[model samples]
Target: MSLQFIKRIFTSGVFLISANVMLSVTSAHAAVNIQQWQTSVGSEVYFVENHDLPILDISVNFPAGSARDTADKSGLASITRYLMTLGAAGMTDEVIANKFADIGAVLGGSFDTDRAALSLRTLSSERERLQALGLFANILQKPDFPESVLAREKARIISGLEESSTQPESISNKAFMSALYGKHPYSLDESGEIDTVAKIKKEDLQAFYQQFYSAKGAVIAIIGDLTREQAQQVAELVSVGLPTTPAPAPIASVPAKNQAKEQRIAHPASQSHILLGHTGIKRNDPDLFPLYVGNYILGGGGFVSRLTEEVREKRGLVYSVYSYFMPMAEAGPFQIGLQTKKDQAEAALALVHETLEKFLNNGVTEAELKAAKSNIIGGFPMRIDSNKKILDYLNVIGFYKLPLNYLDEYNKKVENVTAAQIKDAFNRRLKHDHFVTVIVGDPKAE
Candidate 1:
């Protein structure tokens, strides 16, 4: 059938179902059966077959995040990804959107410090599935990087940067990352700077795509109404035509900070934005479970957390205060952030430090540990309760080379964490004296 006919049917809602019903059908069970393989062109494929719903989700990831860009072209990776689907293989962005809309398929992607991902959610029927896959494959392998689109996107990004420069929250975040990472690529904004983005050319995008979007480094995650054999076929179809270049080098190690440092940027805003952090653990760290559980009690558990109880509930220094460990390809930051009146920023920050140090020195109580585990394990099902969530896990697993049974053992890992383990892990992983702090709208700023 022609795409026009499909578009008419789709618009008429003939092929649509209630999203809640579909999600209920795909709710994860006690364990997920993940099958793994490699395409002929060397892309690693992870598959989970669930015939309950007539929907399919696929995520294709490459090690082409902003970290791949050089200092001179710091926004190269981001712009390359942004412009990829805008015009590929003689198709305009409008055509691409219309084609996906015709079959009720969604094409989306994500970029971060470690990976760039392209994803598709479509009906599992052969016609819709194959058509969507064809367009996706073409965009992956044959992006034209049209000069007009490149120029337009560059202008859009540069304008955003200019606007963000005046915003105190944005200013604080940029300064915090720069302070925490120093010379590392993680310090670079995912949205390239105005100057760097303006200098990015079509040739730069082509080179970046060719070097990093290669089959050798691709991770394809497929989950839905398909057999293992069919999943293999789908993987081969999407990956076979990608660039054959070898995998790029690993991201450089994050440097350590030996002393605590702080930066105060003056802004005209009424409240101060404070972010303080140090390097934390990687995705596959041995202490991950302990740290994860510990962090929940320390600050991640919403109003029930120690940070909130001490900083917000009791003293009213701020409305909210929180902390989290962002585990990445390397040790991502363990960040604590809060906002308060400009005059109260120092008091809020001092309390945050005291809370953290007390937690580190004394460790969590048995009650706190139990509550954290109970909360974590109770919510475990939601983590995989839908195909999209499972697809996300598949991407992380494949990209980080995590164990195949990671999900199967997720609750078990959380359950096994103990008060002692939390204490040891936090003490070893975070330092009380080596934090990098950035405060914007500081009252004391000259």
Candidate 2:
């Protein structure tokens, strides 16, 4: 916000210094007052001090991800992620929950192919925030993995997995990932298979925790009413307490596409579950901005998107049809998927393919480019509307080592992106024929 905007807010009788307004301003400046440090015991830390609100958000990630899980014990990382805060270092699950409740804090986490993260959001009222953060730090740095809690969380997790197995979407996703990744560890679903989850033991969790929770692989991001010293303390608070050393990074390669082929799986469902994509752009690809804007014109945006207008509005091929590419460490998959009646599956699929093929050839129209630009540039402010959202952007920026003026230059970049650029970039990189298409449903049998 400019001084004039603040003046206008003041003139309108809004608090001359509302905490939310202050946070928005600080994030807009995007200089992040980011402080850096290392803990005495060897933890790397990143900090941003904002005295705007009485709220603190802290998140830490380590390499304790599925890539590190043993092949036979694929789900162990996921189970460990859930069980950490369930009980840790002399604290029972009930006691842990009660302690957090007493202080009005929440703790949670998830493990994915690349990393595992634990996070907490709490009121920055001195003692409550400290108490909550301390407990979270202990769990990450020294989880007890108590036997009973592990047993219970595993059982609950297994139950959910079994239920998921019956869903067509889950089946299609499993097949899609397995087919796309081939023999790579990335193919293993983070939730793991049923037998794998069953084999997870308390000791496994402890060993995995010990190896991957080091500060060397950790990234901590925080936004709140904390001083630079306080934020560093909080970052060091989480990981320096852990055994220090970096886990060996994984050796993985992007899978190649076996495009122009169709594989069908038999399933008992009303509508076929459809998934399609080849490898997509990597997280740090230079083509990021151009391709992103191009994709919005293609599918990522709803209703106004070419995919929706052609597949849904013109032909009524399916209730909803969409496409997206998840940029990851390597080229991720670009997928276009939807479902119609069993008999209409082929017809719907045909229309989707035709629309995409046309898009690949002609690219987006001039009107489409104008609208996409307008919608994208118009709503860019919401990208950093909240501290939490800004933290997400900062995480990406920090992890990807993007330019400090990324947000400031956002609009200029969008404005400079022409229809010709979108077309050229999409055509150069997007090989639709390279993607594998997987359909799971008894369309023929039905």
- Candidate whose TM-score is highest: 1
Best by lDDT: 1
Worst 10 residues of 1 by lDDT: 19-28
* Residue 293 error, candidate 2, Å: 1.1
Evaluate candidate 1 by giving its C-alpha RMSD to the native, one decimal: 6.7
lDDT against the true structure, each candidate: 0.88, 0.73
Q: Per-residue lDDT for 391-441 in model 1, tens only?
A: 999999999999888998899999999999999999998988999999999
Q: Against the true structure, candidate 1 has what lDDT?
A: 0.88
Candidate 2 runs further than 4 Å off: 1-44, 258-261
**Candidate 2 — what's its lDDT?**
0.73
Clashes of each: 0, 1
